[model samples]
Target: MGAAFRARTPSLAQLFDEDMLGDDLEAWLNESFLLKRTFRTCAVIAGLIDQRHPGKEKTGRQVTVSADLIYDVLRMHEPDHILLEATRHDAATGLLDIGRLGSMLKRIKGHITHRRLDRISPLAVPVMLEIGRESVHGEAHDFLLTEAADELIIEAMGIGHTAGE
Candidate 1:
């Protein structure tokens, strides 16, 4: 028998370790949210995590779904991100119940049209929203795209009304 060697398998926490991301991840998240209130909420939550953990690992399986990061980056004060993440995770795992996501997608489609931004061509929005929704269901991937979608609609509406004025 040749020398025995075991393939190293990184733990779930290892994959999303905070050391690998540093402040950049925080910065990116902040910029992604952009709105002063949203940014502040995210920042406060992140700071709380840092304070509570002190020297412990700040990423991994916990952070991926169960930690404050989820609230900071996705859930926070809304359920849209939670729903979207759940949908995405289900899709990635091949365990997605198409009928369920189809219904959610239908809801998303209604929102998109309501924003009047459908004219801008929203090909990827549905897919991303589905995935984002899946993430909240403890499926793979981090961060849902729901917040971005809302921001896009808010911005689009702002522009639409301004143009009319």
Candidate 2:
């Protein structure tokens, strides 16, 4: 937690209530797809995607694979896979790091002094606006990446044709 990183944003700060502790925090996190996203991200870092393969331009019988399918297979077959565990350990954001965050959560949950806010809060307007913004930007970014990948694939084919090897 660097002082420079602290921009005094109340968005995340306001979500915390004194009554709600670690178990609540874990529950809150479970609702998000952060685990799956982290797994994919770590998969790339772990060299599982294989974006680089020499002479890929002339590869024959190439088969396209959907990321969702791979994730489904891994999840169903090996729930406690190294990739998923690596996500918890090596993820840049450390959102699911069970070591430090889990310990802090245990300490927080130990204090069973009073009841808590069982339901969620009412920050509907801002959340929707942020989500809308993210959706637009995410779609645009994804399109740009797709375009770049298509260009690479076409260029690779051209190389194969011209070289005739």
Candidate 3:
């Protein structure tokens, strides 16, 4: 039975890595578009920790994130607000402040509806949906970054064209 199970499935660490990557990508997108803040990464990490190990904040249960994973995501995304030194951690501490996380979540939720309506481009919605799916289930981190850069270029060009006319 053990041999058969081993032959048919991925190891637990592999599965956990995939899950963590997915969550990290989701959190990246949420930080990029919705929250537009680097500190929101901490909020996202805290939320994931809470989901995995509930009641930590209230019960004083220790919730922690792998600093390496956080650094990798931040390096890739290059959020405007994160400082280089912030990712470093001592051997014994969690990266996020649990007390601040709840308030960040509340602020994000409160602003989302209005922000979504104001910010999302109608033409980009379909592509955004595809990007969302790719972000969640596929390795499309570069794709998302490229799309955002291209969009900014196109918008800038449009502005230049309008100004010339």
Whose lDDT is higher: candidate 1's or candidate 3's?
A: 3
Error of 2 at 125 (Å): 19
Position 130, candidate 1: lDDT: 56
* Model 1 agreement with the true structure over 1-165: per-residue lDDT tens digits: 011112214532343343544465445433332222333344445553233356776555543333344444564566465343443443334433445544655554424321234353578567656554322232222235666578889999999999999
Which runs of model 3 end up more than 4 angstroms from their true locations? 1-52, 58-139
Computed on alpha carbons, the lDDT of every model, listed in order, comes to: 0.44, 0.56, 0.47
Candidate 3 local lDDT, 71-153, one digit each (tens): 45766777443442332221013323433444555445424321224577888687677555332324577777889899999
Q: Model 2, 13-50: lDDT tens per residue?
A: 33333345457655544333565566667777786664
How much lDDT does candidate 1 score?
A: 0.44
Top-scoring candidate (TM-score): 2
Instruction: Give the TM-score of each candidate.
Output: 0.17, 0.37, 0.25
135 Cα displacement, candidate 2 (Å): 7.3
* Candidate 1, poorest ten consecutive residues by summed lDDT: 1-10
After superposition on all CA atoms, what RMSD does each candidate show versus the true structure? 22.5, 16.3, 19.5
